[model samples]
Target: MTVLYRRVLGAALDDLPPQLLALHDSADPRTWSGQARIWRGAGILSRLIGWVMRLPPQGDAVPVSVSFIPQDGGEVWQRDFAGHTFMSYQYQAPNAQPGIVNERFGMIDVTVAFQTDRDRLVLEPMAWAFGPLPLPKALLPTGQSFETQIDDRFVFDVEIAMPWVGQIATYRGWLLPTE
Candidate 1:
């Protein structure tokens, strides 16, 4: 599932438009916070009636863990680390109703990285709940053997080369948007 996710995300980024690509390139700017969106998905919906009755709010330092599977189907798995966020605005269902609902609020990032290889990359928290901020480069890994990115228009793309898989592979038209 992780491998499939990486491949799907990578394909999305590869198909972004030139203008959107520029937005993503300028993403690491001082005003970078405004360049991306933050998103938090939680809470359970009522099965009989579609509504968010109870919600699970995230804590100050939530653990974002990563696990890597060897390409050759080896038992030796490589694992990375954890990431944390303090208070992100919660997106809740309105009035606990099926059709009737209040609007939701959340943020998103132009590009989000979950580097499984600790030797490759690490993300250091900057700011949260207030506005988007630039992710420090020091926290990022040196080599780019595997990674992912999303464009300004919310178009995502990713690339991965594991020991098991020689290179990236997928069905054609993998990144095209469908209505």
Candidate 2:
């Protein structure tokens, strides 16, 4: 089966850098391990939401592991930073353009537009929903989630921020495929 990102990116997948392509083109379950730095927001709202969302605690060079399990038309991603664990689901956005993908982190479902430019894959949030109810685009919580190949490593940076609450958390790191 075609991977979710490859399906969304279509023929454009060929244009991605080798490191980026290596991570996305797996036919079997894949696990990558590495280290990361996590920064949590200092506000009360940010902490509460981070806890509810199972965001990792702030730490430098924390152990990180990511496992991707393929599904029918989507994939389930399990992530671990330090000892904290979280998971998300990814699938093609129904009735949307080729570059749009729906990702659900816990109860919050987010639609993101995927853009590939040379070596970088950027995920820009375009819509949000909780359960079955649609949410305002203005309040979508994700900001500047992207992945790229840097210095022969698969690097990722994801920022979670809301309208008035400010930065919820940012986890940035590099990983390599592990047996």
Candidate 3:
């Protein structure tokens, strides 16, 4: 099925950091595997929510794998942590709007914001909805960062926080493209 839309890396994505641009350059689909350490903040409520979200338990460094499959207008991202498949998301890149992500739970609108700190690229949640009901963005505090480390590894960090619940989960890791 051909999805009619602008290129995945359009003008809006031109300002992205070189490292991020390279990492997300999905013109040729491939898989990358590496090792990473995962961490989750502590709190009873946070732990409970993390469990419900299928987040990995706090642990030392483990193996992580990711695959990027290009589509007509966007891509599919599949991630596995420590040999366990966590989640897969289908992304749709709009012509002049934030990218849309369709996950198992719901659909989320994500805006890519560039941080001055080392030209890091951050994914900010703009809107979220389940079924036909719109949900408050505050209810789902999610953050994602991509940066290049000194060792030339592509680093990725993700955090999900909820009001009064502290940090539900967080994971930081580095990856190297295998092919």
Candidate 4:
């Protein structure tokens, strides 16, 4: 009774999170947990609805266009770039279990930066909110602003703003060329 969680981004179907797959394995109609049951139900619905009206997942990675509006009322830098960017929202409730720790939780912000250099236009980020500030002066030889190069593959750098976790948390990954 194992269930494999799967997701398809664009035309490529990808595996789901390990936690999600585990939930499917342990799901039982007679003894199903609250949250796990909900997830199973939603997945079933997704399959049924998908047959009637197939819709694409909005979170898929795609080449997106961005217009750089003046943050300080400067000039606009609008250009077409092969990249994907995303943001997220989450909600949490206080723990009210007997004798358990109770706490108040608020909003969280996650910003992701991704780039695929199809056209190979080198773009540098001036202001970044999610990661450590100042690009670790050691990495830059000039001790000035950091520079990024566009290549054949996409690179992802993420900054998660969850005061609950930490003031600032960053994660970076690159899709290296396999071919």
lDDT leader = 2
C-alpha lDDT values of all predictions? 0.24, 0.88, 0.62, 0.23
Q: How many residue pairs clash in each candidate?
A: 16, 0, 0, 0
Report the lDDT tens digits of candidate 1 across residue range 138-172: 33212232222334222222221223223221101
TM-score of 4: 0.20
* Global local distance difference test of model 3: 0.62
Instruction: List the lowest-lDDT window of 10 residues for candidate 1.
Output: 169-178
Clash-forming residue pairs, model 4: none
Q: Give me the runs in candidate 3 sitting further than 4 Å from their true place.
A: 1-18, 93-118
lDDT of 2 at 128: 88
Model 2: ten consecutive residues of lowest lDDT: 18-27
Question: TM-score: which is higher, 2 or 4?
Answer: 2
TM-scores, all models, native as reference: 0.17, 0.96, 0.76, 0.20
Model 4 / residue 136 / CA error / Å: 24
